[model samples]
Target: MIKKRVLCFSAILSIMVLSKLQSRPQGISIENPYKQIMLEHAARLKEEAKSPRNNSKAYFSSLTFAEASVPTEDVKVKSKLSQYLAKFSFKKVRSHEMHNRADKYLPKIAKILKSYGIPEDFKYIPIVESGLDPRVSSHKGAGGYWQFMPTTARLYGLKVNGNVDERKDFIKSTHAAARYLKSLYEEFGDWTLVAAAYNVGGGSLKSSIRNQKKDDYYKLRLNGETASYVYKIISVKEVIENPRMYGYKI
Candidate 1:
């Protein structure tokens, strides 16, 4: 009788367990909230994948700025990009010397940028800054391929003096630029903001962000030059990478 009682209790317990399991949904756990969230996310992604907008070429052709991909859907960015593309087109441009210089120096600059873990897209900065001319100097006294001012050059370990200015050295200046860019990225946490700070100075850009309560480089109200700086870089990248697309023989 005792054995029979024990067996009957065991059978009842098994039925209860089986009933609970059968009532619950398949392939889902009630205890794991993270798994449920992931399952929902996967379902959402599957639906998005079916959307035609996600499959468009324009969506895929987004340009990368310092490893951050930006869609080309913004009207301001598109307008600025179009202007530069037309300007850099073979028929509109006077000389291909810029392209030639880029071919010569980009390999070394790219290697230095890579060594510092910077994006290769930053190699185009020298092209826009000084037209890849090592001897070029701005009216404000910034010089070299990377265009470091005297004070900034000194700050980055480049010796900038009357007789021996290391800012004119492409190799050294490129390294200095990389260091400066890396520091800016660390502070701002955004490559686009880094480029803006590089143009307008960190203090000024920070002030703008604080006052306007806007951190986005594209949306921020910056000076004319700072506003167009990143777009110019993107345009340069597009033309350089797709020379044939822009009708350039080089």
Candidate 2:
């Protein structure tokens, strides 16, 4: 009878162990909870790898002159980028309108720039120049999306008369800007310098280059606006391309 009882107790213990095993989750070992935590952590990392916020380098690398023109490693460029990133506000920028206009216009601008062998990055100029607003004008005589002064507008095959300002015509002005940028690239042989020349004028940039004996845009001591111009463009590019990273819904 004692032997019978011992056998019954053994059978009951086996059933209890089997029931406990079945009640626990599948594929997860209670003996090693850390392995499940590690698996979860690895999955989270994989998901983060696919997110843009964690892939800023990939975005930067995809751009033309990714390293040469907008060197984020440079102190001045980094500081200016921080300033602009801080300054960028989706509410103030009218994110929906700006993004909608960008979606409408940036492809055309990129096409023109591409036709001229200009870096597609130059398409960001209008974003920095006029907030992509074709009707916007500067305190100076600069007007339109490209922000061309009247004389520069006329020089670049844009009509600047009272009746019609071709600078406000997105397509025509983009073409003109493309041509102007091409000419500037010929002069500077550097897209970064071309951007600087576009901002401060070829003559002023040339003089600065000659006087400072520095051909590098990052090294040149320029007026505040001109100095920050390229950095602002880079910043705009970053904010636009990584809007969610900058707290911009659009």
Candidate 3:
């Protein structure tokens, strides 16, 4: 009689447990906890976007100028950047043209610079040098993307003879430019100075820095082109990187 009572009680307990489980909501689940988080994110996406909270600061946040000299705040630098922003870069035709040309050459130049442990941002040097045009020639005989003179080209292991000027060869010229930039980096230990030295030669930049005794690119009394060289680079960097900010379509 006692055993029979115990059996009956066990059966009653199992039925009660089943009934409690069945009473719970039908579709709720704990299988994937991330489901709740993802649903919250989906709701957020449905909300409207807001404009930049601080437009001026936010616009410049895209530009770091990392591993290069001339901060965005410097007067001369800003002046040059402003010049491009106001005129050529913001004008859709011009901005589109330079960027379209840049697309072909910057990748190879950036890769070569990286291989030599140089800053990849130095790729913009070509945009400053020749607007990424391999066939361009300056009044002073500087040629190719990096605008190396024949002597400098030869020195950097590029053949610059009548039959073959390797400076015109994008692949070889990028390598030569990397080598030349590495040497400049060694001389000045500053990428901005390296770029300046590239434009006016290392000896000239060294002399200017010594004469000025300022050891600052902004203060060094350079020729108009060289004085404006780094600022131009920074300017191009700003506009090219932030085309939309300058009102460029692409």
Assess each prediction's global lDDT (C-alpha) against the native.
0.82, 0.80, 0.75
**How do the residues 1-250 of candidate 3 rate in per-residue lDDT, one tens digit apiece?**
9999999999999999999988865554653456778887877664312223125445444444535434556666556656655554666566677888777777877778899988877888877788777888999898887788999999989998879888878888888888988999888988778878888999988888888786777778889889887767776776776676566653
Return the top candidate by TM-score: 1
Prediction 2 TM-score vs. true: 0.72
For candidate 3, what is the TM-score? Answer: 0.73
Q: Estimate each model's TM-score.
A: 0.74, 0.72, 0.73
Q: In model 3, how large is the Cα lDDT of residue 81?
A: 56
Whole-model lDDT, candidate 3? Answer: 0.75
Candidate rank order under lDDT: 1, 2, 3
> Can you rank all candidates by TM-score, best first?
1, 3, 2
lDDT of 2 at 137: 84
Clashing pairs in 3: none
Tens digit per residue, CA lDDT, model 1, 53-147:
35545633566787787656777666666777667755656437767777899899999999998888888888888898888898999898888
The C-alpha stretches of model 2 lying farther than 4 A from their native spots are 1-69, 89-93
Per-residue lDDT, model 1, residue 30, is: 61
Q: Which stretches of candidate 1 lie over 4 Å from their true place?
A: 1-61
